[model samples]
Target: MSSTQSTAQIAGSGEGGKAFPIPQGMSLSYWLQGVRASPLLDHRTTEQLSKSAEVVIIGSGMTGTLTAYELLTRPNPPKSIVILEAREMCSGATGRNAGHCKPDQYRGFAKYSELFGADQAKKVLEHQFKTWTRVVDYVRKENVACDLWVGDTLDVAMSKEVASQLAAVYNDYKAYGGKVDHINYISDSAEAEKVSRLKGAQALWAWKASTLYPWKLVAHLMKACLAKGLNLHTWTPVTSVSASPSIPAFWDVITPRGTISTPTVVYATNAYTSSVLPSFAKYIQPTAHMCDKVVPPRAYAGSRALQNSYNVRMPGGTSYSINPRSNTDGIILFGGNNPNQALLKAYLDADPNRLFDDSLSNFKPITDAVRDLTSTAFEGWSDDAPAAGIGPEYSWSGILGQSADALPFVGKVPDHPGQWICAGFHGHGMVHIFNCAPGLVTLIQGGTWADTGLPECLELTPERLAKINERANNVGKRVV
Candidate 1:
């Protein structure tokens, strides 16, 4: 389990309400030194276009920023380009991610390969590999310091059932000519401890995983796009799009601030896509994405600490990741729909923190539960200080679209020509978008979706849109 804090009790970022307790050994100098850097994306008055551009993109996060950069720097650039954001650039999911910019080495392509086909799986793999390399290269070349890190991730299995399940899938990945070099399934508690630093654990290690500070990275990219002369605006929420066969080459996009007429439009609003279109609403579902930051004791951040990312399969149906930031201190960022379901009910009920008080009591049992389950294997781990207790520094939620068949619904909106979309990345936007955005740009400019090089499954279809709408409508308790 986990702690349940009432919305009121959950730590807020203000003065004299409830002081945040700074952890022991946490000096002002150290805190200042540890703060990550982000790129500049000015959030001020909304920008007005002297004239509508040839192409207008919505959202200013990675997806939109990356695509804008590609378009402006292409062999033949668009006549004019504009990026409209509802808030500061990178303020959405792009800034809120764990900043782990690694390929999809852990989420085995076996199941996806089986369901889609070997060729499609290979394409997905290629897309992620290229994206990973591009991100690292951009960060390095631009001299962006967002705590870029490179390390393998351990998918720890606490039970035989999980071990068996992973073993079979690991072999399947190998059979499909995929990368499995760093994956090590360990049954010995001693061996697992060496890699995970968590006692009483068994795990499968995926070697190519990495992490970074997401907000800073996105901000840097946004800044670079501006340096390239692309027009960008903030706090401009698009209300709707009027595109029909009669106006195939143009769309009248309405916003709270004003209206813009553009020949082409691209959407980078992943979770909030449905908010603009009633049909899209049935596709993307907004759910609570919860994670907590903690200052583990110095011993935990030392050389003997958990070397890489750790995803633990513990009691109940919950999955947790033990991630070590550059410094010794680490944070636990993991969850699935299962645990969230129970937490959501309790959270919706009358002030669970006052009633059940699980946040530090029953709910937060997992904090110590993992240690007790392993007998100090995660030794040195301690409860968060009042300053950075279980509460997130900036916790918020965004919607992500899910295809009925569990693939991305990319490309043009059928029946609405000249209007393109690049949302619905499931939960793997980092892995999917770096290349997907560039490819979509090409398709939008050249007027051929075939040039995207993605599988047909990723393309929009009537059946896919129907299912997307169905899921978008029934997203109640299951979402959180």
Candidate 2:
């Protein structure tokens, strides 16, 4: 449940908008800070390519790492599988995001029902729950040192009007036969405020959710894959991918280094897919987003800290997704909401190349907005909290692939065979990528959609792509 006015309500950069198609070179996030082992991360498994590989994967983000892991660990895996990254390993959305494995259980079901029917809405929501479960299970099974914490998330409504709006959606989802067994709602205002520890909490919704060190999780799996005969190249930007004229039914993946001919090409490149596959320029619109890592003030620091995660909601559909770490530092991961909505609106709609660059958020008003998170949103926050620059010590931006339909574009590419994609996850990649990657691998292995165990609506087809365009044109905006 992430909110960005620029992402939710805007027009796509369009198919012709490919001026700034690739990712920027330098980017560092809160999660990406202090990472060790530069050799394993940016090491060239083989200096020179083998001319061809059974599989070539683009983007070394969550989708890329998970897909490689699934393929390598499974029986009868591909002989040569290569992963190409535009920048450092896992330096994309997966590395920068506020790590929340919470799914949109009921909030977006109504909107989803309108887009892809109620059945798909239910399946999509269910898939997120399963994905979250998989992440938790994977961390425990692998004994990952990624600071995994299994807990509940509090969806706190700041006003009674918002509370009523949420109640209507909850009722709507339940009426449509969406699962409600795992959810618990607090309707009483006093009880809601007490449970959420927010001053003006009018209502509260609680369910199983978690947060973790996202960069650590990806890097951990990446190390395991390297040991399992995976060839990974970091900072290798793939300029383009074209059909092999000499070898029919083969793709020539052209990089600055060299071209690798392969029968299979998987695009894990979420926001930057348009760089290699121009057809996806309009379908997967890249949008720049911001997040912060804050050292909490005295009131919310140490023993008197925020216990659970929260989606502090306000009117006008804007929100702040807060992750109160269950660690010694108790550093809060704060994200969502843009202070300069008008500026972002113009940037997203007008400039194509600028949106793909996540190095800097053009909106400077975000600094003041992020610093005011605790004081403005939470209860018992000090007025004179540690003078100046203490709040929001580190704030960075990452580019997210905003899908035309709000759902991710998974499975095979529409018109191109042997070319698969699993991207455009909005900000819900943490909950969706765990499952979507394996499903994509299933399709790549000559299996049907049913064999992948994914929702039908998630499949990438010409029909769906056409519908995305139709909606953007008909509705005058791609957001809903």
Candidate 3:
């Protein structure tokens, strides 16, 4: 079948059994609606696919596009680079995420300290903070029109229990000699409520962070890569990848179009990594997450708008990340997973690949809970009918690659010499991918791990894999 015919069939194929279909009710983000529909270099390539390239990068999201950009910009670039996308460019999690680039200032530090050591935990924080800065610098230097905004992000604790836990985590981070200059703590409940504007806020932690149009950034990078001779194929999904039968030391990338034989294959597939690399099936499990855009009333518009982004933490471990869009009439983008049992069970039990198959049936309970939460949870939100008819305008779900150990797997695939991986972001790709992509490029060029300068915890080694599996097994036993 021709590529066009194959793509048509794939689009019509309902759920397509394990193949990752873009979730139903997948509303386009405020960012994606602005970009042109056509991909940068997709149409220029021929339909026939039995091609050969020096490097074949799978998935054209941020990681894949950034990796290609780095490779093409480096001195003595690779002879051939091909990027294949399962759907439209940047339509996956990258396009669907909340667009906040805030790093975990203290919460993750405490967790990482428990998982690894204090030293490694500190490195993780430093790595994330540095990556945030790198993204800021890159966007400014490149003049990318991604509506990048640098501002403070508030982590507001609405309950005493959460407040105490955050205080303990903050103490733990500082006790380990972690940097605290950039973080501001608000322990006074009154002060937190005043600053965060959240009713019943018990405490808050504030730090410098950013928000941006992620789809725009990825599209800009892909365009630059295309200008520098990067071949891109969209609407092309890889069925499987295996060792080349004819060529030694090469792998055959099987797609509906055909096969691409290359010595090096980079899996930037993130949540879909398990579909391509079965070895990581258990390690990098796909979890579905939902986000929505809320059109606020006049109370949140223009000069009365919220000045900073937020991670609002309520009681019962419920939290939501919010970003205010000034250009969109002060509309707020809210995203989070409801802590309710039904919602959690639905998310945990559903197949990541088919979560989008029938979003209404699969996610109605969660989305309804989200709407109710938004209407009642916030400090100034009103559930009563609004004069402006303002409320949640759109709701959508996307898949997040949650690793067993809560850390991304970056570097060479274990036991697979010619294959490399840059997946498993644990739903925090924005803060991690910027630096990780560059580091992965260094590895692809045969550089040492030390040379990449990434956190040691992120290295994808056999030892780390075994430890993650053991941890998962132990947790499973406890649950049983």
Candidate 4:
């Protein structure tokens, strides 16, 4: 789930403002620290744009790259497919995230059951779990050394309120006949603390998750797809899309380089989708997110490092995601809620200010809270520990898309025949993109929603869009 949306609704609907371009030199992401030297960083498929192609995909993040890869590798693939990106490859949320492929096994089951019934809720959870499995399978089968680490993720509660909430969800989901054989819950506070190895652990749940070098994974797949003839153009932003003047049943994707008229266009743009397809302006949203990375002391480093990834919930809706990158440096990625509630209030707001720009200044309190994680949230960090008090100096911000239902909007665009979307992951793209991208391939090949094998709520239907629009209008200026 999106940490920003848990407390407040600042993930403004992609509305109220014109779509802005991502400014250069944004985040110093540990995952992207060495990306500048990679040839794929600025690679363009062609020196000059072709007037036409079989398909055009916007945004070169995971969704876009995977969508193109899936299409190109199909038994009867589309010919001359092109990709358009506004910035460097994989520079979006996929590149800046904490590199988690964790699935929501029980946390959101109750909410989905309440809203869409138990069956759809099960589908949602199952879909994510399957996506995680497929991702791990792909990495293992291909032997991609992107630092893939498959292990359990601890959902630790540090407060009474969160403990009670977790208990309720767990009980409700269990009673509803949801699967729990793969999950382990430590409801006893003492046992939870012992199991999680955290100071204030109240209750905790552990389930399978995978963490890897997300940028490397996306780049590897990008290169593989390029070998199969996918036209990828980085730093070429699609300004807008419209009905082609000369070609019937075709949409012209307008970029600074040129225009491509194709009957099939995929908006895998996530946070930037509304800029090109303005109708999404009312449904999907863009929110600001922050993350930091630091080298850990020997106590939490090397072969003795934490084997489990984590989601630590503090009091008053403050939470943090801790992922020990055992695959690379012993650096732990710390991310989540801005501890200062006052800053969110002051956030370009007091209203629903947009957060599409990736360069938005990060809240210092976020860095401060994460830096002190070793002492404040953990167990057994001595004063004599190696290099204590050295906090993370590499804190950066990225943009995440938030949907009305905290799920993605996938399928054909409303009333727009050829255009399709596979975006609005709510900061949970890693779990959704694998299946969503393949499902998109099914749809592009003239398959029905049922053929796509995705959850019912994920379908981007006219009714769902209108319902979300109504909710946004009811909230008035601030669209959550």
Q: Who wins the lDDT comparison?
A: 2
Model 2 residue 195 lDDT? 88
Which candidate wins on TM-score? 2
lDDT of 4 by residue, 343-377 (tens): 64366353343365455445666666775667776
| Whole-model alpha-carbon lDDT for candidate 1 | 0.59
lDDT of 2 by residue, 1-480 (tens): 122222211222345653443544545677777576556557678887658899999989899999999999998999989999877898988988888889888988888889999899899999999999999999999999998988889888888899999999999999878898888999999999888878778998999899998988998889999999999988777887889987889999887788899999999988877777778877887777777777777778778888899887777777888887966468888876644444665755675555766665425566566656567666767655466645677566788888889889988787788999999998789989999999998888789989989999999988898898888888877763
Give the alpha-carbon lDDT of every model. 0.59, 0.81, 0.78, 0.80
- Over 1-480, each residue of candidate 3 has an lDDT whose tens digit, in order, gives 000111122321112234444432344555655565655524435566548999999999999999999999999899889999877787777987888899887888877887888899999999999999999999999899888888889999878999999899899898888898889999999999889887788999999999988988998898899889888888788778899999999999988888999999999988778667766766776666767677776666667788889998867877788888654446688776555534645654654444332232224555566567666655556734576558776665567777777889899998788898999898799999999999999999989999999999999999998887687677862110
What 10-residue stretch in candidate 2 is worst by lDDT? Answer: 1-10
List candidate 3 segments past 4 Å from native.
Answer: 1-27, 36-38, 41-44, 327-329, 340-344, 347-364, 369-374, 377-379, 383-385, 477-480
- Name the lDDT value of residue 192 in candidate 3: 92
Q: Let me know the TM-score candidate 3 reaches against the reference structure.
A: 0.91
Q: What is the lDDT of residue 261 in candidate 1?
A: 79
Please provide TM-scores, in order, for all candidate models, with all chains considered together.
Answer: 0.77, 0.93, 0.91, 0.92
Q: Regarding lDDT, does 1 or 4 come out ahead?
A: 4
Q: C-alpha displacement of 9 in model 1, angstroms?
A: 27
**Once superposed on the true structure, which residue ranges of model 1 sit more than 4 Å away at CA?**
1-51, 244-248, 315-317, 327-341, 345-377, 382-403, 447-450, 463-480
Deviation in angstroms for 336 in model 1? 5.9
Candidate 2 residue 94 Cα shift, in angstroms, is 0.4
Candidate 1 root-mean-square deviation in Å: 8.4
Model 2 spans with C-alpha error above 4 angstroms? 1-15, 21-23, 338-342, 345-351, 361-363, 383-389
The positional error of residue 88 in candidate 4, measured at the CA in angstroms, is 0.3
